[model samples]
Target: MIRVLIADDQSLVRAGFRVLIDSEDDMVVVAEAGDGATAAELTGGTRPDVVLMDIQMPGTDGLEGIRRITADPDLAAVRILILTTFDDDAYAVAGISAGASGFLLKTTAPAQLLHGIRVVAGGEELLAPGLTRRLIARLTTPTPPAVDDTTFADLTAREREVVTLVAEGLSNDEITKRLFISLATAKTHVSRALGKLGARDRAQLVTLAYRHGLVRPD
Candidate 1:
């Protein structure tokens, strides 16, 4: 089962999420916290597979909690998905930079929210292409120097191609179709790329791709 922890300041919000998650046969809410500090503490103790974290909590906040959790080697398997208001794109970017698996608007449909949790728990990045492009572009001011080829010198040309498509927000099935390769091949390429890049997950790979200029904002 995929264990989840809900971290939101509002009791009603936590209760609602608990009910929804408990209804899933393949998932469960193992714990809940009303603040970032408590969330971080529970994560260490419970070691949940996924955390649905509210970005704005009373203290410590989601960003700091994410940082703390991601920094702990013992919690490396935990995936954090930030919950944000519709207009809080900046918070989403910050959460991603701090090692969150992804972010979702609180208004997201129930089906989509469930799917996103599964995706993140299964070690996939869940980004809408347009939103990702915009978020990266907005934060790319005073652009850093393009990542040197040597940085990815370990990856084969085909693997590099696969990584680029992943950064473009394509799913493994999409990559398979785009490259006319088998689904297993696509998955293998992505896995290999992740290993070579030393990325914790696909989201980190996407961030690296952007920072290194493999994928341009435009």
Candidate 2:
């Protein structure tokens, strides 16, 4: 079963999410926290496979909680999914930069939310193409400048292509199909890119791509 932790300031929201997640045969709610600090503490204790975090919380906040959990090598396997009421892309970007595996609005359908949790737990990011474009648009105000190849001087041509696809929200499988490369090759490329870029995961890869203007709103 996929173990999950719910971190939200609202007791009702936490209760509702608990019930929904518990109903899933593949997942179970392992713990709950009302703030980021407690979330980090509970996370260290529970070590759930996935954390459904709220970006806005009373004290400490979910962004800080994500940073704390991700910084700990012991909790490196723990994946965080940002579940919030806010529909703003800036908050989503912040959460992604802090190490969240995905971001979804609270109004997301129950089925989609459950699927997103599964995706994150399975080590896949949950950004759709439209959401990806919107996120880029939110960052590049007037226009995203041309990509700087010098910014990626360390990446080989193949690695650059792989990282670009990743920032475009493509999965390893999708990238393999798109580039006509083997699945293992795709995975290796992504791994190498992460190491070379010092990225935590695909989420941070997207953030770095944004910084260097490698991926634009499309």
Candidate 3:
């Protein structure tokens, strides 16, 4: 089962998420926290597979909580999916930089939310379409540049293609179909590109691609 922890300041939101998550046989809500501090404490205790973190918590705030959890050697394996209403590119970029596995708008459909949890738990990043472009644009500063070619130039030509497709918000399966390659091959290329680029996950890949001119936002 995919164990999940919900950390939102609102009781109603927590309850709604719990019900939606627990309804899935493959998932369960293991704990809930009203603030970032409590959420961090619960994460330490539960060691949940995924954490649904709120962005504006009272104590530490979601960004800090994410940093704390991801930085811990013990809890490094746990994934965090920021649950927030704001779709601010700056906030999302900061969260990704801090090692959050993904970001989900609180208004996300139940199926999408569940899919996000599963994707992050499986050691992948979630970048739902429009948000992907926002993250890239936010991180890409023309003067300074968020990523230098030195970081991305290490990728092979094929791997660069894969990275570009990922930045375009294509999934592994979609990349496979577009490139006429097997699914495993597509995944391998993406993994290699991410490693060479020193990206944490798909989200970072999107940012790196745009920052390096591999892909441009629409």
The best candidate in terms of TM-score: 1
lDDT of each: 0.87, 0.86, 0.81
Sorted on TM-score, highest at the top, how do the candidates line up? 1, 2, 3
Off by over 4 Å in 2: 128-131
lDDT of 2: 0.86
TM, every model: 0.92, 0.90, 0.86
The sequence of per-residue lDDT tens digits that candidate 1 reaches over residues 23-112 is 999999999999888999999999999999998888789888998999999999999998887577888888887889888778888999
Please give me the total number of clashing residue pairs in predicted model 3.
0
Per-residue alpha-carbon lDDT of candidate 2 for residues 1-218, written as tens digits (9 for 90 to 100): 99999999999989999999999899999999999999999999999999999888887999999989998999988999987554557777778878888788778889999999988898778874446666676666577778878878899999999998988778889999999999989989888888888887788888788778887766
The alpha-carbon deviation from the true structure for residue 133 of candidate 1, after best TM-score superposition, in angstroms, is 3.5
Instruction: List candidate 1 stretches off by more than 4 Å.
Output: 128-130, 142-147
Q: Give the lDDT ranking, best first.
A: 1, 2, 3
Error of 1 at 193 (Å): 1.8
Q: How does model 2 score by TM-score?
A: 0.90
Error of 1 at 69 (Å): 0.8
What TM-score, to 2 decimals, does candidate 1 have? 0.92
